[model samples]
Target: MKQFLIFVKKECLHIWRDRRTLVILIGMPIVQIILYGFALTNEVKNSRIAVFDQSKDDATRLITDRIAASRYFNLEKNLNSYKQIGESFREGIVRMVVVFPINFQDDLLHTNHAQIQLIADASDPNTANTLANYASAIVNDYQNALNNDQKLPYNIDVQLRMLYNPELKGAYNFVPGVMALVLMLICAMMTSISIVKEKEMGTMEVILVSPLKPFRIVLAKTVPYLLVSLLNIISILLLSVYALDVPIKGSIFLLMAESTLFTITSLSLGILISNFSRTQQSAMFTSMMSLFLPTLLFSGFLFPIENMPKALQIISNIVPAKWYYIIVKAVMIKGLGITAIWKETLILMGMTLLLLGISIRNFKIRLA
Candidate 1:
């Protein structure tokens, strides 16, 4: 126990002295949350919209007024012809071009319908769709205003339930991903490289030759990383809950326990990588390209799994971060119980076991 304490103290001292680790561990999350939370928002607001009102009627004017009044769109330029639309888009002047056909008011009065051309830039498909929806909603509201007294056939209304994220807050999604990524980087990557560095620097060899057992050495190395990762978890949680106003409807105790479990899994993964790579650089690179990249890309962070190609969806299944993301989202956002996330919990545990097993086997073989 005393020896373990001494080893842990040494690890802490090393981490404290390393400015690079401190910057990455502490600095990365701050930058990610502030920049990403504000920048990559799902809320569609102040999008540029170009109006080409050919009808020039009161109804067209009213519709334009409605769009301009809504905070979702900013009224930009009044385009004269379709030819200018391409140029406007090239200049990044507008996200959408709304063109009212020549007889928009007449068509609506007689046929109870009118054609309004909407040309949207699909570069950012989600934003483009949101802009189109804003226009459609404005038109629908205008139609309702014109025919408020008229009785409709069948009333079809859409009841939207954003299962995990009801409010569709971008932070809800980004927070967990950031947590996972930060832990993986700070926990797995740092520990793996640090262990490999010890090996290369002859410290690990000296330790192995000493009375301390290999398992004890491994435990000492991993325990510090586990603590560091948990600290990061706390930082992320506090930022998400108090700073960002994201909720933690589930038990804080449960969230911490699962996070510790996840950290253990990541620590084991770091140990496994350290065993494989002969150098710290290789371990760091492997952890990033092989671990972090997949976690960020395939863990439903940037894109939804449902929308991904079938082959990619199958690939995503193997990613431990995806399973952990589901678990964290369930526990934190959805406020689900243990039963709800037990499968995910079991999968993460199983992955930890598998990685540790492979690492131990490889480590023993190397010794032999």
Candidate 2:
């Protein structure tokens, strides 16, 4: 116990002295959240539009006024000719062209139905969809104003209920994901590198041959990293809740408990890697290439799992961080409980057990 405490103290001293590690461990998440919130968003505003009104009548004028007032579309160009619409789209200043057909008001008065062509640049599908919807809504509003006396049967209005994230906030999506990545980097990769450093410095040999038990030495090496990882998690949680106002709809204690599980699992894997690695560089490179890349790419952090090919998705299922990410997302965003995340919990537990068994066996083999 004394020996473990001594080793933990040494590890703390090392962390306290290193300013670069401190900044990355603490400051990175805050910067990332701000960037994600301000820079990445789905809420379209001030979308550039080109209007080609051939009608030049009261109805067309009224509809154009509504579009301008709607705030969704910015009237960047009042085209002299319909030919300009095609040129504008090609130039990329305009996303959509609102073409009011010639004699639109006359047609509306006689045939009781008028149509305006909505041409959108489908290069960016999501933007095009939003642009088309906004245009349709404007036209609908104008038509409804003209014919408010008629009431349709079975008005089925489906109000959107964005569960978890009401605003569909991108920050909420990325925050938990970043937390998972950071924890894995700190707990697993850092611990492995730290142990490998001792070996590279010829200090691990002394520690290994010392009176301290192998398990106690391993425990000591992990203790400091465990503290650092937990501290990093705390910083992230505080920043996310207070700074970003991203809520923890589920149990905070449960989140911490899951974090602890994930941390220990990662640390154990680190120990396994460090035992075999001859140098810190090798350990760092191996963890980065093997664990970090896959965790970042395949864990559904930046990419959607549904969009990934079935084979990649199946392979991703085996990655421990993928399970951890799902657990964090469910707890933080969905506010789900044990009943909701039993499957993920089981998967994470399974990964932890597999890593733990391998680590223990490998450690024994080294001692022999």
Candidate 3:
């Protein structure tokens, strides 16, 4: 136990002495979070929607049924009052709301015109735009049906109102993706390269000669990075909430706990990379190719995974960051609790254990 602690201390001291690396580890997440949060914008779909139907008339019911049946929207709530619209958006319950004013059918039948309002949480403008278009198309189809049956033309005007982020800032969408990307790259890339550095320096052989087992040595090497990653997580969250003006609607404790779990998962992946890599260059390239690209492509942030080909969508299930991104969005943006995210949490846990077990088994084999 003492020897293990000593190994851990030595690794910590070594990292402390490397000022540039320390700065990069601590500083890069902060920079990336701010940069990506402000600069990027993209589209998303398959969003939850709510309906505020003031008219229980047949026309309103038909319109609500059409919107709910569409693949692009899920009818999650039927709000009783106007006040629930803000509550739903703030709680992340629904992305878009469909409202039918009172006397909707009467207005359409007698006056030949009625209004339907589409209110969306425009924190992600592209999503809002797409949803509005999709919903409008559905309503338009209903109008077309009415036109075919009756002599007087029927018109249903779709009015749009954007809530939460009226300006449609990109930060609301990008911050969570940036968090997933930054942590996955920094923790995994740094860890793999650091372990490979020790191997290249021939210090690993000296450590193997110590009384500490090979697994302990590997754990010692990763401890500093795990600690650094926790710090990175804190910095990212602070910047996200303060600098980016993104709120953590869920429990902060749940977010940190999940972040820590993901950090361990990333560290385990790094350790696995170190096992195969003969040099720091190869380790870095491997981490970038394997961890970086997968996180970007499969994480469902920059691109919608549901939009991908069936095979690619299946492939995305294996990426840790994909799950982590979902978890962060649910916890940080949606203000959801563990009950909403337990499946993802369990998947991450299963992944961490599987990766750690493989890494340890390989580390033991290599040392022997």
- The number of the candidate with the highest TM-score is 1
For model 1, residues 100-210, the per-residue Cα lDDT tens digits are 999888998888778988899999998899999989999888887888846578977665677766766788888888877777777788888988888788777667776
Choose the strongest candidate by lDDT: 3
For model 3, residues 218-335, the per-residue Cα lDDT tens digits are 8898898888888888898889888888889889999999998998899999999988998899999999999989999999888999999999999999999999999988988878
- Model 3, position 221, has a per-residue lDDT of 89
lDDT of 2 at 275: 74
Q: Model 3 Cα displacement at 27 (Å)?
A: 1.2
Candidate order by lDDT, highest to lowest? 3, 1, 2
Which parts of model 2 are misplaced by more than 4 Å? 41-46, 56-75, 153-160, 364-368
Error of 1 at 266 (Å): 0.8
Each prediction's RMSD over C-alphas, in Å, is: 2.5, 3.1, 13.0
TM-score for candidate 3:
0.69
> Which prediction has more favorable lDDT, 1 or 2?
1
The C-alpha stretches of model 3 lying farther than 4 A from their native spots are 42-167, 364-368
For model 2, what is the alpha-carbon lDDT of residue 195? 82
Q: Best to worst by TM-score, what's the order? A: 1, 2, 3
Cα lDDT tens digits, model 2, 1-368, are 78778878988888779889777766765666666655765567679988899989999989988887777899888887867877998899899888999999999999997899988999999899988998898898778788883657986655568777786667787777777778787787888988878776877777887777877878888888888788878878887888778889999999999999998888988988887887888998888887888888888888888898899999898878888898998998889888888888888888888887787667632332
